[model samples]
Target: MALLILTMVRTGEGSINSLGAGGLITLEERDTLIAFQDFSFDTDGWDRAIQENSLPGLGPVLDGSVDTAVERVFALPEETALATIRFDMFLNGGWGREDTIHIILGEIQTLALGWPSDNSELVTFARDGLSVLAQSALLDPIRDNHRVARYSVELAVSFPADRLTLRLVPELVDGAQSNWAIDNVSVVARGPEA
Candidate 1:
């Protein structure tokens, strides 16, 4: 069997409205599912930096340049059973005085089949609307020399197979500054049969 490609959209230029319209596949039935691979963010200069040194009280600074970004890759069907999300990230760059990376899994939304309407909205991974699936922090005060800081996280969701959406946000911590980069961002789904 082959892997299903869900959505391959990029965020950062501005706010994106619908997941399916942004390249995400809409779910038709409860058993619908998809997966993602080679998710990336490459900037030309300092202009595309999402948030450099945006976090306070955190060590290291973030620099926003073409070399600074986030990358992640994941196989959903392999790590998850029934409905799971998995990803591996690589953060490369130099930390100045106070810069850090804030990796977040954005809200999840339920959409109709074919994504007929712009029913997509910012939602929570948890039903309580409080807890989130996964999040992480990257600090580089020592200037790891862009050594590919690696991270991975997995989540178990209760929503229907095809009606789920995932989002990621990377930001700088504190007012610090440094150059950051990312690569290999992916999201996949796994079921009992897989």
Candidate 2:
């Protein structure tokens, strides 16, 4: 498992603020270059509104205090390991263990692990201890059935690429409403795949 360093940054201001919020996770010695505020809908990069509403008891936003799930286009400086895109993600509301968040890399779709159907999944097996505790404590009673929690999953696929458009699709398998939030998304070069 590669080590990930999580850090948050903010740009612009208020709800209409562009770029909204973003995060960066360093992978040690790797050259990570990101243009701040590039994720704003106003810009040509990100496509969608940057959500700014407070997530009840979830405290401030995980990184930049701006929570949003929007599609964006990015180019890898070099060839990247499209097989696995890793990042920090959060899910809220009633979702089943089988329900997954779709990672669309260019045209490929990889179903990533998502929140469990029951709240007990957190207390029982402690799948994600910190995220579960944060979600359980900050979840609003009226908003959704359960609190919000964060998890990091490596989206497995075998596509190598120099540029890719990415989007996260939330599919509710159990006919329940759910929200997915993400931050610190990144793709690292894996050289030529033999």
Candidate 3:
């Protein structure tokens, strides 16, 4: 019995056991690339106005302090083992404690952080956690010396995600006093099948 148990246990992680002709066959799982966003030409596969509010003189970006947010629904297989989301994010104008962003992923959270038991995944980045950039890239001559910064952020998540809803919402502190942006986003999943 011990020999049989050890034989079954050494098939490697994410390997499926299949009974073949008088033997066991193991199937391996691999990563599946799912590129969700390419903001170079236009914004596709993303929610319209709500997901993005373009600045009058800027390239494609999701802009708004809190009132506007970016949301994308990814339809993946029900057996996805791992997922990674990547994006280039930035915040323009002044920001404070209230400028933190919330990342809510349905099933990606491994442990509960006192949020709702419904898997309320939460993560943040603001203030000192990013690199401040020059506002000259903003192109608007409205004023000078406004707090501006950008960061390339990524998150590792898990899912049996049939319908995955990923949302990035900034806290609404002073009601649209400042704006933010996100671009070059992508999501990759790994599983037994596509």
TM-score per model over all chains: 0.36, 0.52, 0.56
Write one digit per residue (lDDT tens) for candidate 3, span 17-104. Answer: 2211001222345765565443534666666432443432234565544455567787775577766565545566555544566656
Assess candidate 2 and give its lDDT. 0.43
lDDT, ranked from best to worst: 3, 2, 1
Rank candidates, TM-score, best first: 3, 2, 1
- Quote the positional error of residue 41 for candidate 1 in Å: 14
Which runs of model 1 end up more than 4 angstroms from their true locations?
1-33, 39-81, 96-144, 174-186, 190-194
Better of 1 and 2 by lDDT: 2
Q: What digit string (tens of lDDT, one per residue) describes model 1 on residues 72-156?
A: 2332333334454444333454333334444333344321111012222232354532233332333333343332233333445
- Of 1 and 3, which scores higher on lDDT? 3
Q: After superposition, how far is residue 54 of candidate 1 from its true place, in Å?
A: 22
Off by over 4 Å in 2: 1-24, 27-30, 35-44, 57-70, 78-85, 96-98, 117-145, 155-159, 187-194
Over 61-166, each residue of candidate 2 has an lDDT whose tens digit, in order, gives 2222123345666666555443234454566666566666665666755444466444423221122111111111223353545666555444433334566566
Name the TM-score of candidate 3.
Answer: 0.56
